[model samples]
Target chain A: MHKNIESQLLKLIPPQSKVLDLGSGNGEFLEKLSKKNISCHGIEIDTKKIIISLAKGVSVTQKDIDKGLKEFCGLGFDFVVMANSIQCLRRPLEALNNIFEIANECAVTIPNFGYWKIRLKLLNGKMPVSSSLPAKWYETKNIHLCTIKDFEDLCADNNITIKKRVYLDADLNPLKSWFTLNSNFFASEAIYHLEKK
Target chain B: MKIQQNSFEYKESFHLLNGGSIPGFELVYETYGELNPNKNNAVLVCHAFSGSHRAAGVDKETDKPGWWNEFIGPNKAIDTNKYFVVSPNNLGSCYGSTGPATLNPATKKPFGKDFPLLDVYDWVASQNLLRKSLDIQSWEMVLGGSLGGMQALEWSISFPENIKKAGIIAATSLISSQNIALNQVARDIIRKDINFEDGDYLIANKKPRDGLRVARMLGHITYLSESNFKNRFGRKLQDINNKIDSSINFEVENYLRYQGEKFSEYFDANSYILLTKIMDSFNPAGRYNDNLVDALRHCKAKLLILSFDDDWLFPTEYSKELHFAAIMAGINSSFIELSGNNGHDSFLYANEEYVSAISNFLNHA
Candidate 1:
């Protein structure tokens, strides 16, 4: 799943482009991106992750993503990547706007809370737990969990253009099923390549 | 671990950053482990204001562990077995180094007030001389907390290529005005002592005991948080038995006075005055017209900054400032705000999380 996330991001980020990572945990992915000649700087607040990120010699600012990216406004980064972190924020709407303000091109990966399997679990009177949302209801870090449709509605409401959208299954594998048209109910998660309209 | 102090005397005249010069000086330092053949594994630990060369190991004479014994040992945070550790006493400090208490060759009297006032840059320069004397090409890491942290930051900036990494803990790039004011009160308390004699108490054959004692007591308040103080000695009285006589003393007062008395017994009055003044004026950004990014632009060394959330003396925001400058200057840096009640003194403690943070950052290849 981690490798799949990397490959998906690698496909969008070209060589020699500057990247800003919203929640660059441990700087592992940024370090990988740096190997491809991509300049990467990150903003992370977790103490353990920041320590590891620094030990790896990656440039990361210790900051809360919920605070937004006002300081980075107009920095003209080629890409601002938010991976599996949008659901954990208190102000997802403001964060989306903040991401669009920093760069014209950005990538956001989120767990689809509205997947069909999740609906079935809820219908069966149980809290949904998939690989994408592995934590128990009480243990979950997500405060703004949203479905793919909800996210798309948010983007549409804020004039964010969806350049390309890739749907992934429970194991984060990109699903190429015939019914991808109804992805809001089938996919467990998503990789979104968005642009500022 | 058993350790011995070593002395290095630079015969040439040592110049101060303040356009003053001393006719040669000596620096006493302690070393642990062995310097590698490549000469790149030396970790230099700069001492805080009242700190000494004894950063780790047991002093054979005193049978006491060094200040950072909890962090630097065979398999500790610095890992002495893998890296050579060197801790040096600054020039103006009174820990077996050339200081105000040391005899001057000019008139065969203690330098005292005549001792050229030194700054953080001077300490860094003197440390560099020691580094050259040891024949180390560049340091593996230079680290410290408080005043020591200032020295580490200075080393990274002044001798940028000479240091590979710097760990600055509980320090600020610039001393805030409130801090200067507090330090001023401490310095004035010492200076106004009847025996101070214009910082020449040594020549007068008198020690400013009362002045130094009161000053340290006042200075100690800023080093801890209110919650930590409460934890240690809140409203508890030291003497519950003296109720009839009403000679009651609070546990906090007793603790402060005890610490102050112990400090005054050893620390030189002039040295205290000079060192606190150095802490007063440490603004690297001042040279760059108050632009922190431009001040940090020339730094090639990677930085690890650790700040305590409860440290009001140098708050977490100050550490964040350095992180911001490091990022904007295109340097690799990381900042960690550890949660603890020890306040400014939190960096000196061996908190498990703090230890791991230091260990992982320093030992990373």
Candidate 2:
């Protein structure tokens, strides 16, 4: 599933573009990007993850996204990515707004909380847990999970134009008619490319 | 292949009198290669905290190469063939220069903790004396990294008429709170140790080995990026014959331990304390002067500040801040963030791109 998402991301970004990966866990994506000559930078709050990222030679700043992106002004980067980390943010929208202001393009990937499995589990009075989100509610960093449709609507409300959208099933296979039916059932994750209006 | 040692006495040993006097010391310096009649081919190379007047080529005592042999040589960046190079052992340093470790004739003992807090400006004042002693009016370039970069910045600002170009690498305008706090913690560790004996351990034949080791360990963490640590050490375990206690402890622990242990052999604990404190008090911003731009406005040199992408100790943002200040000051300054996985030590590592960028910059300068 991670491999599929990575391949799709690689297709979207140009080779050698400067990229900043927010909440860049272990810098896996930046390492992949660097092989393609992309100048990669990252920010992660976790000290352990930061150590791992630095070991890979990825230029990462240890910072909290809640503080806004002020360090990167005038030093331009082509893309800012928040992968599987949007839900973990205290103020996800505000962070996204700052990302858009600093980057020429922004990409984000989030788990669809309204998937049928989660819905059925909630209906049975049980908190949802799946391969995509394996943590218990107390242990989870996914505080602000949202559905694909809800995310698109939020983007629209924020005046952030969707440049591209890709949907994946539970196994990360491309989902057909993902923009419509997948918000509630078939799709497990949604990847969106956004540009500031 | 013989290197000569040069010496001179300061007009008055501020190391003796009012300990806080600036522009108080006279500098005695040695030069390699010939100085041009106009003296425009001169290159000033500032030393690190513990480094000495010998920067390039070989040292006579240990039959070892100079500290920065990789960067300065016949065909190197600051080519001795084309440029007359001058390296001064900074004031408050131990290398044949006037420092806290030096003997005070009046006190008949080492200055110990009584050494005045030396800043980048103090180092520049000594360099000015050295320049006058050599009969050289100005320098074509002033270059350094780490503590040396601080001196280079001072040369640009304090003696703007002397330097034509300045190259500052892997340095910060102001030491961050984290660094200051870290140094304070290390100092506390040393001070609390019974062996330290209030910095009078010399009489007792005791040294703060444990305290200095802990300080170096803390400092070593900041010197390398997390990325470098993981790549070099990761979760690798130390080799052991006994299987009962076998555990895959991270390799970084052993590496840092080696660094700390080895550092003690070559460095003095009290000097380490003093140097770190100097680094902490290094605020180019000046007292009651919050305006960095105004502070840097006096610089006339074409400045270049380089930061490694992975160097968390003195992160790229610090370099960016300096670059911004230089711009507002109308100084011709360029900031380049080089790609490297080695963190802060990348400047010292065998990085081809890093070397190329610097080589190009110096050639153009």
Candidate 3:
């Protein structure tokens, strides 16, 4: 899953572009990105992750995503990426707007909370639990889980242009032949490439 | 690498921030790695409140490793092999530095209450003199934790062009009212002691050992988080030789008592009061229109600020304030909070993440 995201993110970024990653975790993705000649900086709140990221030669700052990106100057980064982290943010839309102010392009990956399997589990009178989201309801870090269609609507409301959309299955394998109209229910995860309108 | 305790004295009288001046003062320091001919590879490490110049390697007297021995070595985070590391004992300290315990050159008596009150700014001013005397034109980095962190921050602001980078760990830009209250309570305990003869306890041949012990006991509690206390000691009772007395019940109480007593044996009561005052008075935004962001504007070096999640004393909010200020000032800055159960003292512990953060900032950033 990590490798798949890396490859996909690599395709989106231009060589030598300055990138900022929100919720960059231990900076594994940024470290990998640096190998492709990209300069990556990250904002992570976890001390352990920040340390690991720093040790790997990634420039990561300790800052909460909820506070927005006021520390970064406008258009300082060519690209900004938030991987598997938007749902956990207290203000997902606000954070995205802040990132858009600092980067020309952005990418965000989120697990689809409205997948068919999840809908089936809900119909069976059980809270859906899957490998992508292993935590119990109370212990889960994600607070704003959304489906592909729900996210697209949010983008439209915020006047953000969805340049590219990719759907993937449970194992992170891209579903090339997936139906666009029912992607929200069929896809397990979705990655959206975004630009400000 | 081998570490040696070295000393330097300023023959010219140095003026104090509060009032008065030190006629002649000495600063004790330790060095790891050799100074390069160009002197650009030097790094100054300011010590915390009670810490001394012996930051790494074994001390000859105690035969124990330096307080920061784990973090500074050949292959450690702040590798001595690549940079020259200098750790200094602050002036108003009991540890091998000119302090209340030092004898007055004029009267042949311990300076005692006569020692001038020195703040973090004073320490930085004095340190700058030492830097110049050593023929160092600039420093590669100036790093410290807690009160030491305040000194490092002061150095960056006072001598911006002279420092290339700075690491401030578990520190604050301004001491809060609550923090001052806590220190006041500690100072009051020391002053209320019957043996504390107006800071002339040494002349009276009496020491405020009990008062100092109580102060340290309270400080130790503040240094540890609730979770760490519960995990380490909890409500577990100590083995008291089959006695049911109320003297020492919980293992935690015994631990605090032991630490307090051990500390009083080596640490001076007057020095404790003085150092805590300096810590309380630290305000990095003082000269820059009383605005933290404005003060940070003058800082030319790259900055790194670190805080611990469980460090309720300095806390993560303080680090954020400093980080935001650094950014607003347009200084190259980074901030991160390391997860720890040890609370404020987490900076002293051996955490891989903490090590890597410092190493990466120094080597890469």
Candidate 4:
């Protein structure tokens, strides 16, 4: 995830709207939402994270995303945020299906595998391993990693509408005009705001 | 601080929702800490199936600490120093309260099987009497785990204005058929015991020890997780030197036998049946045409639901259902699943994080 993850998400959600944060890590993002008067709930997997969230007076449920969000169906949340979480799931497709069933809109961030730097690394005939993409192929938690084009294809095929998409460089800085022109080939990561079509 | 056992007698006949009435009933209870002048700093503790009014402090005669001593004491999770704690034995319990084991005024004999069945509503009504007797306007928090948790939720639903906050731990608002089926096996075993005599064993100066023992053993199975059992007593045997073909039993068997033996010795079979029946009959949503959102619509208390990851009997899913209803019904609510290996009985165990989580909710929420 980007260093400005909360700041980036904080901009998308309006005050007092009900939001469900998927994979709320350590509850810092939820705390930020609470300050803005947003009625926010979180689904976190780690016990320590849940405890921290509880202490903050934020209602967070401990659940495994890989198990799917069937219980959260019909919750009617305004927005759902999945910052650097979808790729780690065993079945990202099923996760998406359940998420759309619950929330009207979603904010998702993913590391772009089609970045020009990653393409250059592939030319060396080695699986890329850098500060940006640190894990080796064998031990990477990103089992369902995908490029921006692939994700867009998934959304288009599933009747989902991408309202907004932002591309960032390796340093998490938003790409400017020329870089945005070829985002799939140059951007290091991408954030998208999606709605069910 | 030291605690003492007390009794509150309602002289008038206490009527049950089922049209059965008791001429007069007594509730044995205990109080810890001094009630403030305003009486707003009061906390009520509801006990589970076999829990007692002795939820805190040690008994002077036996020198044994109460059941929930880990969570309720001078400076425990439920700090008696800061809040007045009231724990009462429900009416239909064998624990000093008026139940089947008590002599009936009409026949001058134990009520036995004739003792009318009681439910969560009956207990809440009787407890409301006790609350009035104490002159407390509203409880700061009413909380419990398992059957006790069900009673706590009943408080919020039935007396919406009297309880400021309710913490439901390791319990469900409605008992599933799966849970009822589990209780049925135990019920059948107890009813068929030769010495049970149709719950009239007290008149015969005999106890349904075998039947009650088997029931408790079966109950012990659901109160724990398979992982907990495995971790506690895996392949260990009572007599390790004995060959596998011999009559040696595993440590788990020995533990269950010990638990059953103790439970049957002190707990009454008739009370056991009555309490389980109460548990099965607890569905507040039934009155609202099975809509939990409508059932909780009038509740004013902030609700906190806590579940354990390993509590298969009432898992985190059950708590999530409650959370869904609470939110939809427009109530301030929270649901937390504590990570633990202790299963349904995790609330009774003294873990730092678990205790802090609850105390934080009680103090802040």
Candidate closest to the true structure, highest DockQ: 1
Model 3 chain A weakest 10-residue run by lDDT: A68-77
The per-candidate count of clashes, in order, stands at: 0, 5, 3, 0
Residue range A13-48, candidate 1, lDDT tens digits: 867778998899989898888778788888888987
Docking quality tier of candidate 3? Answer: acceptable
- The digit string of per-residue lDDT tens for model 2 on B23-114 reads 24535455666678887778888876656777767766878777677777677766677778887777776666766656665676776666
| RMSD over all Cα atoms, model 1 | 2.2
lDDT of 4 by residue, B227-266 (tens): 9999999988776654332454787777788789889999
Choose the strongest candidate by TM-score: 1
TM-score for chain A as predicted in candidate 1:
0.94
Off by over 4 Å in 4: A1-8, A14-16, A35-37, A111-159, A166-190, B2-4, B33-38, B227-254, B309-312, B315-317, B327-343
TM-score of 2: 0.62
RMSD of each predicted structure: 2.2, 12.6, 5.5, 4.2
Q: Report the C-alpha lDDT of model 1 over B115-172, residue by residue, as the tens digit.
A: 8878798899999999999999899899999999888888887899899899999998
TM-score winner, 3 or 4: 4
Stretches of candidate 2 off by over 4 Å are A1-197, B1-4, B13-19, B22-31, B60-64, B240-251
DockQ of 4: 0.34
lDDT of 4 by residue, A1-197 (tens): 34475677777776667888899877778777887888877888787667666667667776899887876776657789998888889998788878888887889988898998898999999988877678999988888878999999999999889988888887787888898889999888889888895
Error of 2 at A67 (Å): 18
lDDT of each residue in A1-197, candidate 2, tens digit only: 29999988878887667787888887789888877877776777764564455445444555678887766654567788888998998999998888877786888998998788888889999889899989999999889999888898899998999999888888886786744454557678988888895
For residue A1, model 2's alpha carbon misses the true position, in angstroms, by 46
